[model samples]
Target: MGMSAGYELARRGFKTLLIDAFDPPHPNGSHHGEPRLIRHAYHGGEAYVRLALRADERWLELEAAAGEKLLERAGVLNMSDPDVYTFDGRLDDALKLGVRLEMLDVPEIVKRWPGVRLPDTYRAMYEPDAGYLYSERCVAAYKKLALKAGAELVTNTFVTDVKAENSIVSVRTKDDTFLAGHVVLSAGAWFKTLEPFIKLPIRAVRKSVAWFEPRGTLFDAGTFPGFTLGTKAGGYYGFPNIAGAGVKLGRHDTGVEWTPGEPFEPFGAYPEDEGYLRRTLETFLPDSAGKLLNGAACKYELTPDDNFIIDTHPHHSNVILAGGFSGHGFKFASVVGEIAADLIERRVSDQDLRLFSVARFAVAR
Candidate 1:
């Protein structure tokens, strides 16, 4: 979100300076996963569909500007549990938004994705245009464009303090203190690092991803679609074997609670993570579970209700806060970037963002 926001702001003729605690596209952040799924099912809420629609456009624009294929058009298969929340609003939004999506039954899913085996309680929503984003390439493209647009990027600079007062925001680093007319805090898991200064209902938790070599062409990208499923155990998501590398799988639920100070412990360090994936495959994609090629651990910053927060700080209007994506936000990064820039410019966005306000959490607290 920070990279995309900096790029947009710089493109809008704002003198932008993007500073990262570590050089971006590194393995440390949520963005380091092999690829992130971008779909419009938007079970998060219908409020997100508009932003997702805009983000799809923005991603296309970025791809055209960068002249690189950043997004894949592989379809998405949303496998939901009828025993749980049955009406996934995406069914309604698909028609309203003119998105070409179809509802698939258990048999249809099994027919479409030969490797997937699900119970009768599961149904699927298929969106043809939904796909995956090559995450690292996206950061590189945004960085290149932002730099070309006259934005300065400083990496490996840890932020020590962020002070917003009297129309000016001061950000202190280990080496220097910088002041700006406004600030956008898009800090991910480390959002708590801001401390009592910014109280948010966010928790940083460990998450895992595992890659498995497919047994046959049955699980390759050309024939299979990226999918998310609600099993009896929990929710699981995965991508097809793109370029024959392997099938990638992950879980949505949080792992162990983590903090910035002691964050780098690998997810696989907990043997249960691997055991869970093995069970997930043995039950769902039995044939595709050939060999575990590799695994990775990352952090997920979450909110209690799993909704996001995108609003101005309660007391400081000049300080905009953008965090709490709750494991499902990269697809909206483009639109969020535009909204962040719009907030900084003090302009009303055509799309409503009231659902993401900070006050909602405060009232609940």
Candidate 2:
């Protein structure tokens, strides 16, 4: 998101300087895995659905600008307990926005991809315009575009503090002090450490993604689709095999409370996580659970309500806080980037950012 914003700002002739603690496309942050789901029948709200649609448009714009493919068109199948209240507003938003979707019973879903079996009462929402985004590739693309647009790219430089005084924004790094009319804080997990003086409502939690060898062609790209399943027990999501590698699965909840300095070990390094993945795969998709492959961990900077915090600093108007994001924020990077640039350039946001404001936390300045 930081790079996307920088690219947009530079494209609009803003003298933008993007700083990062580590060079991107590294395995230290949240968006490191192979693919992330992009769906229009969203679980957040109508405003998020609108943002996702705009993001989809921006993704196409990037593909055209970069002259290559980034998003794949594999449909997403959302299987959940029909009685759960999670999809209540989601259904209304999808219908109101005219997002193309279909309702399928357990039998129909199993018939579509016979590797997975489900209870007779479960329901599915199949979104046709949904698929996966090659995550790290996306970062590389935005970095290229930003550099091409004349944005100063500074990697391997860590930010120490960001303070604003007398309507002037100053960013202090380890060895340098830089000034700007506006500063954006896109440091993912390190944002907590950078602004420890302010009591923000963000927590850095570690999550895992597991992979499994496919038993047969039923779970391959040709027949199967990317899937999300939820029950009273828990929920799991997975993608089809990429280049004959293997299928990928991830649980939506945070595993262990993570700090910034800890190592990002492979997921199965802990026996409990491996056991959890095994049980989840054995119960959900028995046929697809052929062999237990490897897994890895990542970070999610969570907000109190799982929405984003895209508002300006409560004490300083020249600083913007683009944190929280939940775990599903990667798909909206393009639109959020545009929003960041809009906030920095126009002094007002183009999108309604009330749901993701820092005022919800009510912190003491």
Candidate 3:
């Protein structure tokens, strides 16, 4: 998010300065694990569909600018019980925004795509336009663009303090201090670093992603599509074998909280902590879940409502706060980049962002 925003701002001639604790393509952040799902039908809420629509356009723009295939239109399959809340709102939002999508039943899904298996109650929603984003490459591309646009980029430099004085936002790094006309606080999972200054009610949850070799031909691109299955327990999402290693699987419910900049340590409390996740392959996705090949940790800065907060600081208009993407925000980096830049440039977005404002948290509009 920071990289995209910084690059967009610089491209728009903002005299931007993009700083990060680590260099570009760092794996310590969320833009890792090969691919991120980009679904048009947002299950969280309908309002997100608006942001996602803009995101689609910006992603294409970035793809064209980078001269690389950043987004793959492999389509996304959503599976859940009829009672379970899925991207039903995504359909409404996409229809309202003129995005092409479809909702399918079990037979229709099975007939169209024979690789997946669901319970009798499970239904599906398919979005042909939704697919996957090449996260790491996109980040590198944005950073490159930002640098080419004459934006100063400093890496391996941690921000220690932020002092805003009536619109002159100043950021203090470990070694030096710099000031800007406006500041965008887009620190990802490390958003807690600004707690003393912003007092945001966000929590960083340590999450993991696991890759499993396919059992049979189920992992083929013709059969399996990137999908999110909503079980009675929670949501489990996966990607096809885009990287040739295997199918990528991740859980949405299991995560631990840690302070910003803290070293990550794996928990070995429950067998399921490691074993159970792998065992799920034997039960749920027997064909796809074979040997647990690799797993790595990422972080999610979550809000109570599991939505994002993308607005200015309630007390500090000069300092824009654009974090708390919940867990599924990487797909919107393109649009969010433009939105952050627009907010800084005092331009208006066609999408209504009132639902994402800090005022909703009682910070005073």
Candidate 4:
């Protein structure tokens, strides 16, 4: 996400400098997974539909520029009970916005996609436009482009403080100081620690991802589209083996609490967390859960309402903050990069950012 913003800024001729505490595409940060779900019919809200739509174009543009496949057109199936949040305002709004989608009964979903079984009561909304994003590849591409665009790339640099005076923003690292017309805090989970801090309603929770060998052709890409399971007992979401290792499954809410610098090793794959995911798979599609291959841990910067905080600091206008994505923000990284660029350029975007403003959190904007 950092590289996305940085590259966009550099591309816009901002003399940008991209800094990272840890080298990206590395497990030290949140975005390490092979694929992240990209669904336009967002369960979060309809306001995100336009942003998601714009992001799709950016993804294709990045893919073309990188000369590599960064997004898969596998489609996405949002399975849920009729009354669940996924089917209500979120899907309804997408429909109103002219997003293409198909409603499916349990039998229809199961019959059409023989990879898994759906309960009789389960319903689904299939977005043929939805698919998966190659997170690691995208970050790598962004970093490469940023450097090629003459943006200074600094890695292993620890940003200790950010101070704004008048309209100038000074970013101080452990070893050097740099100045910029504006500062963007796309620092992911660590944004809470920055100076002149805008108290983010973000909780960094440890999340785990597991891979399982397919029982049969059920996990084949031709049959299994990327899917989000919205069951009664919470849910899990994943993609097929397009990028190739095995099928991936991640529990949305089944994460452990951990702070920065804490060891994620001991906490990942805890029995209960695994049990919850395993139980869900067992109930819905046992064949897909037979053999677990590998698992790893990541973090989610969750907001109270699970929305993002993408706005300038109320007290410190020079510092722009973008964090608290819950877990579904990666797919929108493309448009978000442009949004951050706009903020840095001090342009008022036609897109309404009220839902993501810092003022929404009662932070005196």
What are the lDDT figures for the candidates, one per model? 0.84, 0.82, 0.79, 0.79
Better of 1 and 2 by TM-score: 1
lDDT of 3 by residue, 251-299 (tens): 8876787788677765343345456566655555677777767777777
Off by over 4 Å in 1: 363-365
Candidate number that wins on lDDT, 1 or 3: 1
What is candidate 2's lDDT per residue for 188-250, written digit by digit as tens?
Answer: 766677755355768888888877887878778757778898877677788987777678888
Separate clash counts for every candidate: 0, 1, 1, 0
In candidate 4, list every pair of residues with a backbone clash.
none
Ranking according to lDDT, highest score first: 1, 2, 4, 3
- When 1 and 2 are scored with lDDT, the better candidate is 1
Please write out the lDDT profile of model 1 over residues 1-365, one tens digit for every residue: 99999999999999899989999878877888668889876765668777788889999999999999999989888887888646456678656777778888888788777788888778788889999898889988999999999999989988878888788989989999988997888889988888666888798988898888888799888788888877667888899998867888899975889888884787568887788887888888888787888788888899888888898888888888889885788888888888999988865676688888899886321
Model 2 spans > 4 angstroms off: 263-265
Q: Flag the better candidate by lDDT, 2 or 3.
A: 2
Kindly list the per-residue Cα lDDT of model 4 for residues 272-308, writing each as its tens digit: 6466666777777777776777777787888788888
Model 1 earns a TM-score of: 0.96
Best by lDDT: 1
lDDT of candidate model 4 versus the reference: 0.79
Best by TM-score: 1
Clashing pairs in 1: none
What TM-score, computed on C-alpha atoms, does each candidate reach?
Answer: 0.96, 0.96, 0.94, 0.95
Model 4 scores worst on lDDT over the 10 consecutive residues at 265-274
Candidate RMSDs in order: 1.6, 1.6, 2.1, 1.8
